[model samples]
Target: MDVAVEVEDLWFTYPGSTEPTLRGINLRIERGSFTIIAGPSGCGKTTLCRCFNGLIPHFYGGTLRGRVLVNGIDVASRSTHELAREVGMVFQEPEDQLICLSVEREIAFGPENLGLPTEEVKSRVEEALKALRIEHLRDKAPFELSGGEQQKVAIAAALALKPSVLVLDEPTSNLDPVSALELTKALIELNEEGLTVILVEHRLDLVARYADQVVLMDRGAVLVQGDPREALSSEEALRLGVAVPKPIRLFKQLLVHGVKLARPPLTSEELAEGLVEFLGRHRG
Candidate 1:
């Protein structure tokens, strides 16, 4: 197994904070897998993501214990610039990450900063823009675009770096439902293209549909991490305020109502097919 990220007994604390934000965290992410880190507010999801990109101990000053390796490089030993090339990050708010004047400049900023050849930067910018389907907005000012458009531009900028792993924190928190769906589809497409994606999001339904693994956290500790189906179906997930997909909830309800199904459905499509089979069996 090609490992993209590895953390062992990680611990972190902010200046003047009474309690540590993370405690003895251990996690490993496989290359090319889509994983979601989910928890309620203040559960250290964002803090853990920052560590993945070397933001916690590097950017923030505090006592750090443990090791975080990204693409075989120890995060604590690598500089922020070096880590940025290996792990691209997209924040919850696009405006927070967008510093360039236009979409094209924003996307090209990373490669340019790395001092790549002009042609290479141009090629990467074009590819990133095309991948996100935001070529039409290439010339538009970052401030002038809609929330979804801004997020797409942010993701494009991250992609331009060509990082082995992409870490996104609440990418869909501010978007409308339609925009959220659009962003989710784009993320799924990126994951399909072999980019390792780690997202910290509260929207369970969106991530449940595509996430290969799910990490449920609480009180600055990992509660469970495994295949999304197994982890999300556990009772601990329900007790921690993590939202369950509607299909799974519905399946459980039907099971309680005497409907016999072989497995709990994870998506609407699965639920529909299960219902069809159940009806067919009854008719027979």
Candidate 2:
């Protein structure tokens, strides 16, 4: 399989900190996969993302020992300008990343920085806006949009760069529940369209239904990584404070209530089917 990101024995520490935030971490993400990195705060989920896009050892100063490769280029060796083409990062706070006066310009900024032709940039800007279903907000100032709208605009901006991999750090952290769900749906659609997505989020319930792979981290180290079904089923995930999907947890609880099912259900639809079978078997 084509690898979109590779981290080998990666380690990093901030300037003032005596201990390293990340330690000997290794992971590989396949191209076009939707992967989630989930864990409690300070577990290095965000730090690991920085390495994926060359922000750690490049933009932030620290003692770094390891190799982080994105799209086959070593992050240590690539400039931010070079990495921007292959990897687009959407920060937790959109305000920190947004600078363009209008939503359209914000989406257009990255493509413009890549020195894309005026016509090509325009095409990408339009396509990105359409993809995120935000074309209506094009002419409005970014500051005027709602939190969810701002995030969509931020994502649209990242998309405009046409990156092979997109890393998002808690993209839905600041939105209302409805907006969060909408953004999650948009991200799932993007993944279906074949963009490799790496998400760092605490909202496990929102992502559990859509994630192909889950990477559970703790104290800057990977605790588990695998298919979402297997990974989320592990006790370590719960013990580490990684958010558990309510449906999956509810399924497990039903088992405690003497309900029997063939398999643990991860989605509401599956859970409903399991309940039907359990009730029918008990009735018979």
Candidate 3:
């Protein structure tokens, strides 16, 4: 698999701040992978996500020691505009990016700013809307859409820029349960279509089922990162206050009671299947 993002010995301190937010961080995100980043608040999750898109040293003046690479290009040296082509960052609040009047215009806004030809901009807008399945909402005003639709438009706008990697920081925090689930399904489809996705979310139950890799962070460093079942179910991650998915947690609790399963499950459906198989083996 191609490497999408690489970080080496990264450390950074914001302007007018004495302490660093990230300390000696190292990570590698493979292309077309879906990665979930989890940890308690203020554990440098946001700061690290910023590095992926050159927001660390480019937009925010900070003392950065180390290197961040996106698609094999050094992030520290690239301008934010340059990085935007390769990494699309969607913040916690989707409203922060919905500045345009209509969904199509919103998607067109980024390419237009990049000075692309009018035809190219229109083409990108059309592709983004269709790719996101938001074509029905194209001509509608963004403010009038539902929360889920609004977030979809925001993601479509980011996709219009043709980024290879999409970094979302707590994207579903503000949405209702149904909206959050809808957004999660959309992200999974996007990742399946080969867009590398890095999500920093607290709602494990919502996205854990779709994760290809799980990363746990704490106190300005990555505690552990690996296969979702292994990393999310470990005792170490739970000790650090990282919230594992409920179904995965149940598997862990079962293991403590001398009930051994062949493998941990990442979703409710998997957990149910595992339990049935286990019970069949130990039939009373």
Candidate 4:
């Protein structure tokens, strides 16, 4: 029930850019919750994520205003390296994150840089390998792995940091459909295991079912923010071009024609079950 991240009136402009990429953004994400931020391309989704882990003002060299806090610590007051300990970030492209040659080395990179003992670093690496189910690929070269495997490695590296919050910006962008689904399932599993997850994604139909909270942003401002059931199905979200999961879309379409569903469904399985029950009742 505690807040993992809080943003207040956050405004920022990149170095040499005349306009601000983000404006008046306010959001509160609960700890251990899986939250998704969905918006059109160039909606400042990535810019906002950079702010989450203190990369905006610290590393990106931007003119930042307002405040962004992660785990009660102000982002602007901290160094990127300090923030990396509290907030782990995975970029859209896993290739960008493959700093080391082998998967084992990549996962150990963070802890090693943190000055942990050799045994502690190895233990962290082993823990991340187990957590991400990528131990078999430990000695393999990251570049030689499949896109999904590489993405999993990137996530494992972040997990090795044991951060309080994990912010992923379009983590599945380069993945196949199956790989994307796997990535989302992995995120849900992590959240269930007590890691706070903040995802910036575009494929809502696949990811929506896993998100407890959905946020819609446009023109560098939050348009809707709440439970996925309410926020993802809102007219404002749709009008703003945020894609609603098909189950909810179908449910809404059926209701418009006088057919009432048991309730709004966030997944296809729920919709199917509800429809079967409704048909059975009518046939009786």
Candidate 2 clashing pairs, residues 3+ apart or interchain: none
lDDT of candidate 2 at residue 212, scale 0 to 100? 81
The lDDT of each candidate is 0.90, 0.88, 0.90, 0.90
What stretches of model 1 exceed 4 Å from their correct place?
Answer: 276-284
> TM-scores of the models, in the given order?
0.95, 0.95, 0.95, 0.95
What tens digits encode model 4's per-residue C-alpha lDDT throughout 151-192? 899989988889989999898889999999898888888999
Clashes per prediction? 0, 0, 0, 0
Full-model lDDT, candidate 2: 0.88
Residue 159 of candidate 3: its Cα lDDT? 93
Which candidate would rank higher by lDDT, 2 or 3? 3
Clashing pairs in 1: none
Q: Model 3 residue 149 lDDT?
A: 87
Candidate 3 regions exceeding 4 Å error are none
Clashing pairs in 3: none
lDDT per residue for candidate 3 within 17-98, as digits (tens), equals 9999998988889999999999999999999988999988988988999999999999988899989999998888777779
**1-284, model 1: which lDDT tens digit per residue?**
99999998998888789889999899999999999999889889988989988887889978788999999899999988999989999999999999989999989889999999999999999999999999999999999999999999999998899998999999999999999999999999999999999998888887787888999999888889998877887787889878889888888789889896666678889889999999888885
Local distance difference test, candidate 3? 0.90
> Which clashing pairs does model 4 show?
none
What digit string (tens of lDDT, one per residue) describes model 2 on residues 42-133? 88888888888788888888889989988889999988888888998898888888888999899888888888899999999999999999
